[model samples]
Target: MKLNTNKAVLKPGMTLIELTIVILVLITLISVLFIGAKAYKEGADNATCILNQEQVQKAVRSHQNMNAKNDTESFPHDEVFGATGIISEPTEPTEPDNLYAGMQDDVYPVVGTAYISCTTTNGNGPHAPASTEGW
Candidate 1:
């Protein structure tokens, strides 16, 4: 009587093709996550820029209220209101340049007139201009 011991008949798990497919799926998921994170960061930066603008606007209003009698000629420039040093001073001039230039360039124009311009840095990208309209 001979005993049967043929273990080779059993099939193995997970073929190379299946493993490759799983790896590809994982890579795709990671790519999507990275893209989402980047978008979120940009949005947050935009919000922050807007908030800064609002603060400057409020300060301008306060200044105006304090000197309403001379409102017509009481336009605050960089020197008076320290526009250059509002949030942070820009390396370049914070004049009427590209919108994002001020933020990225590290400049902030005066915020006394009806309209003011604020800019963002290159970190925000071309879409995110360094300058913006203020009240």
Candidate 2:
């Protein structure tokens, strides 16, 4: 009988090409997931900023109600709400210690028509209107 010794067998380990492909796919998937998560975080941050601005608007209206008779001509810069009160300046230079401290800086402009300003780290001024009128 002729010797029948030759046989094909599958390898136990992945081939280099197969391993490379798997690594590439994993990298692509991870990148996509990371980008999606980052976008979600940014959107959440923007929503928080808007909520904060609305609170500031409420404080302004309260101040306006208190000083209706006075010819104040402009919203109080230093003491409409109060010198130490919330809503004194827009965009506190530093991160606030608490929510109230943060609101303290959401002040309306003393001069020309003031609106809720939504700004990024950079100095771009895009305003978001308040939920109610005269914000």
Candidate 3:
């Protein structure tokens, strides 16, 4: 077979503007993703905060209700809202150490807003009911 040498071989390459546009597009996409991630994280934290507040409120209400049933008025101790026991899976900035802003006035998590705000009279936190046979 005979080959023709009249045609020129060519290779396609990106021009400066084309490459710049690609880079800009990539940057925009990355920024959008980062923004979405930030928003999602904030939303997640907010939800967690709400759940913690609800749990603490529930524990407090239960304690109060039980006491009321027995013709007594008492609340769980502060220790109930701190580490070693009551609270669990606390939000990002608020550790178990600072779960309470005050004892019954207005409980605000150190990290986020306690939107629902715990009902008055010191008491506290979150954790699944569990027990162990160990000292």
Candidate 4:
């Protein structure tokens, strides 16, 4: 008796529909993963921004402590303006890449006022100068 390799090898274990279904499932899974990953990245960026704001706050406190004549007083508003040594230069994580949006940028900040009187653009970009209030 001859071997029946041809009989079994020629048999199609999966139909065209089965192959198509498997491909579709894989595509769906990949798309979902990409979306989930994108969201995770966004969350991470926001968290980083919050932490940076906190660091700026600490730096400001340090400056105040070093310069305050009395413990009850804080750094004068004029002294705080245009000072760079106390804190690192703030920058945004995304777009514009500069600290300010533009030469004539106009934004209003409320959340991160305590540290630097600046907030991320639309609460998404990095904290920057919104007004000359905090320092």
Q: For candidate 1, write residues 1-135 as lDDT tens digits.
A: 887776667678898999999999999999999999987876766665555555555555555556553444445354224545333332222233433222322222344332333454436553333444545
Worst 10 contiguous positions by lDDT, candidate 3: 126-135
Task: Name the regions of candidate 4 deviating beyond 4 angstroms.
Answer: 1-9, 69-84, 100-112, 117-135
* Model 4 lDDT at residue 13: 86
Residue-level lDDT of model 4, residues 1-135, one tens digit each, is 877665545655898999999999999999999988887776665665555555655555566567644333434443433464655555655442655222121122233354433345443455433333443
- TM-score (C-alpha, index-matched) for candidate 4: 0.58
Q: Scored by CA lDDT, what does every candidate get?
A: 0.50, 0.55, 0.47, 0.52
lDDT for 76 in candidate 3 is 46
Highest lDDT model number = 2
Best-to-worst order by lDDT is 2, 4, 1, 3
* TM-score of every prediction relative to native: 0.55, 0.58, 0.56, 0.58
Question: Per-residue lDDT tens digits of candidate 2, residues 9-39?
Answer: 8779999999999999999999999988876
- Native-to-model Cα distance after best TM-score fit, residue 90 in candidate 3, in Å: 4.5
Those runs of model 3 whose alpha carbons end farther than 4 Å from true positions after fitting are: 1-9, 69-97, 103-135
Ten residues in sequence with the least summed lDDT for candidate 2: 92-101
